[model samples]
Target: MAPSNQLEVPQKSRVTVVGSGNWGSVAAKLIAFNTLHINSFHDEVRMWVFEETLPSGENLSDVINRTNENVKYLPGIKLPKNVVADPDIEHAVRDANMLVFVTPHQFMEGICKRLVGKIREDAVAISLIKGMEVKREGPCMISSLISEILGISCCVLMGANIANEIAVEKFSEATVGYRENKEIAEKWVQLFNTPYFMVSAVQDVEGVELCGTLKNVVALAAGFVDGLEMGNNTKAAIMRIGLREMKALSKLLFPSVKDNTFFESCGVADLITTCLGGRNRRCADAFARNGGKRSFDELEAEMLQGQKLQGVSTAKEVYEVLSHRGWLELFPLFTTVHEICSGRLAPSAIVEYTEHSARLPLLESPVHLN
Candidate 1:
């Protein structure tokens, strides 16, 4: 349960959003949904807006006053109006009490660096993106990356759930991990928790971040097996093994988080979503169907168009780094998938690796196979 007495929930607060992409847009919408009291404090409180775009490409803009009826992605629901989109990075962080990052993981470091001087020292920083650094960093997770760039500790918002599913106010669960400061963590949980959005608070930043980050790897493997047209028996075996791998890595990397064993929320829950709804799987499917001719970027863009999910370029990056380092003990399926993606091994090799690495007995079929 979230502690109400500890969190400082302001009647109205300014939140600066860093990105306006699919995830960014959903995050901004959530900010508006959670801060519905801003109008009550009209003169006293205004939700100031700050939004940023990629520098090299043409500047991007967000659709404001977009209702669920108007927006195709949004379900039939009403949206709040206080949240405004600003293109200026400096102006966005200026005087804002909360900062939320929804950009891709690769772009977050640079974006945070740009706002380092401008961000209010007291403002809470939160990142919704999940992935590891492209470059070598020993034991550094997404939270550490944010702390390094911002020069301050920040909380992470992550889970197995997807944005489109959340945007529609579907019933789902997520975990908010923060430092030992239980007060700060609960505040965030309360801020985001609505009728349909149930949030759990964790003192373990590493565990929470790892669950969010590593699930992509497992999901990629799941996608590979699924794309191979492996039956549910094979898919189920992969999922169970994937959970064990996640638990082992979690124990090694983040011992503080109680119960590293993956459950529906962290391990099993997120893995299935990513493998089935995940964009990485779609990308893998494209490669499998096309005979691996197109470039990574082309396959990724095509997957996004069809599935409307973020591409897993960063996930593939992490897979490569870990596999090269010989840290393949925990996530063997991921390692296998990585090999297939890199052209070092063929698709059939994935099945062979899983059979070789798995230690537990294969699951018995619950239904008769045709």
Candidate 2:
């Protein structure tokens, strides 16, 4: 069927972005471009906001920077002034066509819960998060949890693409998963599709979400390998095992998604970047570089004393959840977790473990199912 005027043209498309971190800022900017590219807005890109953050890193920013009031993060990007930075929830979601969530994984559910009271039923919600909620039985996958709470099926965007690369308009590609309806899913793919930013559609939202979340775990493992002075061979070995562990864990959580290859764009692509970011890896690297170096607690305390430790608590929660399940055979990277937990296994030992566990098969295709 041809796209009717009603479907082809948005009735009234106003997009609101929920977070203002690096990914959030980049995504909000792109969505502004997407709306403009579709010619869906006649008078500027519908209102957008960076949604401010509080001092403790909570997203409730009380002090607004008037100097940095414009929505475009980079100068000369030429964002339409219509895309305003609104901090109020009611003002942001009111009469909007879509809401995009770009906050940290742990914060997504609470934010989604808050939106339930505000957003209209017809409006579509998009999740750009890449981690699972560390929970038992249900709502483990991020999308499912949001969809269930919102009482509407939510779509997810995941891929090997990076924020910095995309912000500069470099070549990038991504996969959009919509479990609600194929037509709805394709609408987003077509809406944001551009020559440089290739977008594909997939019905396996579970696979996409699980892959997105699990790869970060593998990244921590890779960082551990890096901390240990592991060679390229060792790094490659960790990558292979990491993908397998992702496959096994994803299989257990989202059985609906049968594709087990975690080496795809969303899996391995995201994995490499997370390792290179060097946050969690720094923890291991510090331990590896010095002998009888500061204990984990001492290192964490010392690091927190100087710079912020963002994801240590979240990573610890992930480790604890995995341990509670007693699902060791399912997660070979849990070997890395065990070493981190046991206090006996040094950073170098993580490299040896990677070498020992490197026999898993490589993924056949870099891309997963459609």
Candidate 3:
């Protein structure tokens, strides 16, 4: 028989989102919907807003708290009433046993450092950011960095999810990449899945993440193809080559990575969408249209407003990794993307390099088929 004096657990399971940007807002909205319907979760989804002033002279957090929307980042969308926005990151993460991190990859390390000793001991995290940090040791995935810094298990969610489309409740699918815990992964699926947004879990975190990371570099190449007014055949060729390089790099980095994971929403789906419609592609298109006269930094400022592009940085980082490991010759597409981005080669050189590399057997190696 159970003891009558046993302590009862709180009916409300707390959740917090560690970002309030475009994707962050959508994640909060999705989690807010689930928290209301899923009895195990707390109704209020706390979203940490990195405080900033909008074009108007208003506090962003106050506006979000009052209007129940992230008007600046995700304008024209109504967030649920239960989604609370706070500027205090520490306060935001204090009680949250489940944390969703969707901030820009550049700011993630600082954010993780700040959260030290503040979160619950049993907290689990999910990283939606796509990119990595290249140190002297090597490229560290955002999820891995989070796990190492925060002393928590971190899962990743990646897909062909465009924030604007998801914000409007358009149908989409995402993959949750976890290490070993199926039950934990399912909880994440429950938090994110909806009629419009389907979520599935897989055990290959590195494959899903590398697909998300490297696809941006490919998108840059695709954007060049678009800027050059290249036809569909050229763009298709670039994508095919990019996908092959993506698989090779992922397997090279982590032998445990599964080839089938590349078929999931996080892999090919992400690569396709990013090349066709992502911000990186758009900016790269602009860079190419201008004949590479202006730098990507200048275009990103003029075009993206305040948002950052991940591809350009990812290219340099990946190139650094390849160079350090003496593996640059093994990845022609990857190396060429960086060289082109740095103006060492013309935008047209994207095609030229890939074509030249293809004719040669430089990238050949004994590898598993994807």
Best by TM-score: 3
Model 1 segments more than 4 A misplaced:
1-12, 38-79, 134-139, 306-312, 320-325, 360-370
Q: Give the root-mean-square deviation of each candidate in angstroms.
A: 7.6, 6.1, 2.3
Question: Mind giving the per-residue lDDT tens digits that candidate 1 earns over 1-370?
Answer: 7786897765555666676555566666666676664342222112222333324342323433333221423335444666655666787678776677766677666777787788878777777777767565545666777778777767887876777787787887777878878887876776667777788877777777777777776666666677677877887777777766666656655556556425536556777777677666666666655655565567766556422333355456657556665566545676776667777777666678788769634222212211
Q: What TM-score does structure 2 among the candidates reach? A: 0.77
How would you order the candidates by TM-score, starting with the best?
Answer: 3, 1, 2
Q: Which digits, one per residue and each the tens of the lDDT, describe model 3 over residues 1-370?
A: 7799998886567999999988999999999999999999989999999999977889999999899888888988999999999999999999999999999899999999999999999899999999999988888999999999999999999999999999999999999999999999999999999999999999999998999989999999999999999988999989988888898888888878888999999999999999998999999889889989999999998998777899999999999999998888777888998998899988988888878656655333535422
lDDT: which candidate is best? 3
In candidate 2, what are the lDDT values of residues 1-370, reduced to their tens digit?
A: 7756655544656677776555665666676666766755433333334454444564423222333333233333433444555676666776676767766677777777777867877778778787667666633667777777877668888886666577678877778877758987876776556766788877778888777776665665666667667667777777777777667656665566656334445666666666666344566456556642566556756653322233344345556666676654335465564556346566566665655556534333313411
Q: What clash pairs does model 2 have?
A: none
User: Residue 215 of candidate 1: its Cα lDDT?
Assistant: 74
- Cα RMSD for candidate 2? 6.1
Candidate 1's displacement at residue 100, Å, is: 1.4
lDDT agreement with native, every candidate? 0.63, 0.61, 0.91
Candidate 3 residue runs with Cα over 4 Å from true position: 1-11, 360-370
TM-score of each: 0.81, 0.77, 0.95
